[model samples]
Target: MIGQGCLEQDDLSSSINIMECPNVISINMSASTSPISVSWEEPTAMTTDGKRIAIFNQSHSPGTSFPVNSNTIVTYVFDDISVCSFNIVINVKQVISSPDACECEPNFTFLNCPLNITSDQPAFCGTVPVNWTEPTVIDGCGGSSSVEKTHEPGSEFPAGVTTVTYTFTDSFGNQSICEFDVIVPVVAVEDDSVPPVVSNCPAHIYEVLEPSQTSLIITWDPPTARDDSGLPVSLHQTHSPGDQFTAGGYELVQYTFTDAAGNEAVCEFAVTVYPNGVNIDTQPPTVPPTVYCPAVSYTPPIITVYVENEATSADYNFTWPTGATDNDGVTPTVIASHQEGIQSFPIGFHRTAIFYYDTSGNRKDCYQNILVRRQGSAPTPATVINCPQNVYLEIPEGTSTRVCWEEPVVTDDAGNPIAATLWQRRLHSGAEFFINGNCNEQFVGNTFYDYYGNVIRCGFSVTIRAIGHENLPGQWTQWYNRDRPGGNCDCDTTPSTACSNGEEPIDVQCETLAGDDWLTVGLIPSAPEKRGQVAYCCPRIGFYCWNRWNALYGQQCLDYRVRFKCPLQ
Candidate 1:
């Protein structure tokens, strides 16, 4: 067992040097009514170099009696650092006495029984080998030297739930069995490598909206698809023909065709909508990379560049990104703080900020930093001023991809450039490549090299994450009407007063009575909703702001619009 990165092994002669406390213990009693007395010797913690380490948090003594029916977990700490845990189980023994003579004990138990396993079907799709640690069994009175099981470890299990049963039989043929389920999803088994082909995808288009109309209806011939498997394919679209397109520029329409085997292909087109009466050049032209942050959501990202040779400067080409399309046609103008070209960079720190503008005059900007380092310049360790912002991608788990990003920039005392070195992977870092999961803070070691080959070490933390499957959008339900203007606003909000709508005392059910979702009501910001007031307004969607004339001290009420955020469509 390992805690964080420290290993806790049980073997006395193990090569790991540091041996933890007792392993899992299972004691069986021969008599049914007698409780078993269990005992174990505490092991000494040792270092790899034949040194001794002090242990702390030693809660249990050398031995004790097992509880009648409850389970007892034992824990040990090594050097007040690593944690080790094991379970102690006592089996209830049932003696089968016979007139003929020797009889077998009917009690048979396993140590740390494996739990049910749930796993997605492997890419192989066929029967795959499923394995688990075969549990050790304890036999008290019967000499059960051998064991039998219906399905052994490493046995191939078909897709779906398969029960693996293990049986233990004693010398006198008394038997006991334990079973666990292994489930593999069946949908993923129907796999295909070939994606369907989409035809008649529309090209980019430009249009002028009618002077009187606020929007335009766009239409196109539906794209067709074919699968190499000669099977029908399902088509999903972001927008369909005759969908209303507002005056927003560069609206995207996409359709995806998926074959029966789960392979998919997409067809996409963009349409630029221009407002009324204009010259022949009214159609928007190809604009420069239109960035979408710094103004709206933009924060210039700091980029770090390392100079390889011990020189005053180095020549490096910058990488440009594909900016997002703007609602209004993007302007052709692109601004940069520093002139960009393949030029020599001096041994110092330099920053560049790029600004992008749309036709609407909304500005977005990004930032980059150039750090040129030389041998004789002062050496500085890496500092995380701005790490690369992470994004979610619709990529499958366990998939590997080559990723490149800007490294954070740092400077020395003289304000000269310095770059971090890829020193070493931590013991708990990713194996081979990063897997699909949420971002987590991981410590990384960095080593800096001076002109004389001396090393300067520094440690810092960074979050690493992977893109997950495509997320589905949430849908909201239309507001429901139960309460109206005549309803008692104060009584509705107050727990003591059963809200009366003048007709009868009935509290407004916030979806719970038919429940599942939370029902909300609108609130007029001007009028504060609070107690001590005669009647506060409780306005909600599908219902009007209501106030009971004499409800609660005659407090004034405000209007609000509330709706339910739907969990189900």
Candidate 2:
């Protein structure tokens, strides 16, 4: 076997060595109700032969440990070969644990903290109700029940701002506080009273011409009414003063005046109308003397005379002699001879009489003498011949035609050509146009127009007459019918040289002037059952140049198209 010294040299050198001391330990801890554990690194040493070794506390285990308030010593020993060993004294210390801080701040939620109330408790005539808001507190530690309020929440207070405080203590005994305010105000009331007054009420009377008059107008001074409250008072009328009333009697008219307060007053009057009486007349009239004169020429002279009734009443009618004048101012109820026109009279002392009658049927007569003597031989009469009979002609559409005839052959009883004033010719349809000539003369009728521009024909007539020495018109002739060709008479379809170029060919359509197409062309078909295109040429002269050509042609073509006749050339 080997000696003990030799065995130690082999094992001790590899297992043990002088150890190093651990660093002073320091610990910080929080004061908590639960248990806390602590730990550290063990001391270590190295052998002379380059081997590492561990050291452990001889008095304590390396597992669980507790912190202390003061510094404490722990001894650690390192053994090598069980004969050579060393101790490491570690100084472990503890820092006092700090109590937990209450980090939560107190907060209060006032439902309606800033509240308003009236001093009258219930303002607006008790229309407003009492009101307030409750206060709530919140804390971080969840101990809201520990909160205290200086005043009870939702409690009514006097009219003014009132401050309240809320305090909260958390589980850690940390305290916080919050404050809020409530407010109240004052208000006043309003009053309304008083009524209106009426004034200027008066009465009146009205009279009408006849009792048979049903519509009577009664006017008066309009009354005045006012309200004391400065408000406008409305004036109402059941019956207006100037309204209609019953006939043949007197009636009381009433007017009522009212104020805004429903107060009313009335005034009234009477309306009277008299009855109409029967009217009659029984008077005779006096007649003036008649002036006499000799028959001078074939033309009769005019005579004027006056008559009056002794009673000064114009209530009679009169009958005058032939060729005597009658005044337009004479009425059936009044008789008075004012003036007269005597167209013709015989060549002798002729007695003419005038009779008169009153409205009562009484009658009287007055007589006068007119001495008419022959002046000279009467002038000879005139004669006419060769007046136009009938004429027929064709005029272009929208054009006028002239009708002329050879002068008629005329002569007097002396076989000489009649003077220019002795003869006349007349053309008549619904009206008359006259041509005068004493000697041989020519006549032309007024220009006639075919306004419709149609191709139809129409007729008219003319006549001739002669004047006698007595200025009497005599020659009467039968109507002569003249035929006139209507519009289409001058229409030509061939295009003119000016119409060949320069302007593009517009699509030609056979349509009414109203733009209603009734014809067809190629793919573009018009309304059913119509004709082909109508060629129209626009006259671009003067005023016609500025006008739209299509519109002008359309209007003109409509008439012709409707008549189944093309107006375009």
Candidate 3:
């Protein structure tokens, strides 16, 4: 056995045929020893004698042949020498496992469809492990394929794309159906649709004094809706912020804005207007002066004139000096008047005055000043001219009273004693000293006044006593009063006679003077047994001594108002 390496022992090898089909046979030998001596032929045709080997169909050649060089040996001999030849057979028909095809990968798209059928295709075939077989609609000829077939072999489609048509039946009856398109690539159906957000922005403030008509200003900037990350907004009206206002008046007013997505901006401000009516001038004119009547027996002088109207909106009208004729318009009897004044007026004094115009215009006026002596005629003696007649009294409060008389010999209207015209102190209290008065002891004493307010002397008696260094020498009173108001000689009904000795004397009548009355001094502590200088403590004039001096003179105690060291327990 060489070239094709063929050897058959007991004639059972190549192309398998053993003893008339009862055994095997295979032989091919040729190493080239002798031309006719390398042979072997043993098919003498004996079917059942020794063991059966009659398999000779001419030369036995059906299909396989390839055995040339390399010592090709081709010899086959098997007359009737078969023992156990091969033979076995068992055939069945339907066997199929090869027609597989399900392609649904051509780009499908379906996220929220009519219902649902999944097939997203993204598993690239490693060697065919894909299957789906629940699609059986091949009824009659293939007409019920509206898409409801799925064979479940790795089926996962929920994105849209399907084409699986597999119909197979192999093992000889032979049948096949195939289509591949299980591809799915559209996985973006997670839409939420959201887009909008903008809160608040737009305003204006104004105040510029005065004058205005139209000052361009109206604003906005807030809108951007559709929010889901803490969203709560909804508005749609072209997102307003533009109507158009150009430039008007009074300087300082600016604006420009937009929102709702157009986004724009600008801002500025100021506007004012103010000022109105005021005018005034008050009339005043009229002057006449010149008169010397030193002889109607010599004495008479009185004249006054005034007119006015200034305004703060009192609106005015006033006229004076009527119808004149001194040069003789012939009706020359000029007379005019006006009145109204009193805001306690006394700055230039004028209570309305213009006294005199006659010629038939008749007149008789007087707004102040007029006195022409000689009516009952008789009064010419009041010459105590210089000063100091006698007056010094102080008992205004416990322990203080002085009056040292005898210094009133000052005279000059030709009575001779005018030593340098001295002394002046006037006291008249009843308006509770409404202002300047701190000469202590309410000092309304030390008197004298004469420059037409004649008093020439009413104080000069000197003698006051009440001394208590630290506390308690306070209480004394005397010099209550005597009689020295005297008679006042006159001049022209006294015309206030220049205060004629401080006037207050009408028809004459006088009385009273018996040890003067006002003397009170006290220091009592539960009556230390009638403590010192005891001047009748619990008696003399009952009512409890006038109610203990009426609680020690508290209620204006007889109009004296005196309190001396009386404040203690």
Best model number under TM-score: 1
Relative to the unseen true structure, what is the Cα RMSD of model 3?
A: 61.3
lDDT by residue for model 1 (158-187), tens = 544566666566665544445566754323
Candidate 1, position 552, lDDT: 20
TM-score of structure candidate 1? 0.25
> TM-score for every candidate vs. truth?
0.25, 0.14, 0.14
Q: Using alpha carbons, what is the TM-score of model 3?
A: 0.14
Ranking by TM-score: 1, 2, 3
Worst window of 10 by summed lDDT in candidate 2: 541-550
Q: Please, what are the lDDT tens digits per residue for candidate 2 over residues 89-201?
A: 12122222348533433222222222122233412111223444653444333654466776674465542334565554445444333344443321121111122344566
* lDDT, each prediction: 0.46, 0.32, 0.25
lDDT of 1: 0.46
Model 2 misplaced stretches (Cα beyond 4 Å) = 1-196, 211-214, 248-250, 274-569
> What TM-score does candidate 2 reach?
0.14
Among all windows of ten consecutive residues in candidate 1, which has the lowest summed lDDT? Answer: 533-542
Instruction: Give stretches of model 1 more than 4 Å off.
Output: 1-20, 23-91, 97-128, 131-151, 156-165, 171-562, 565-569
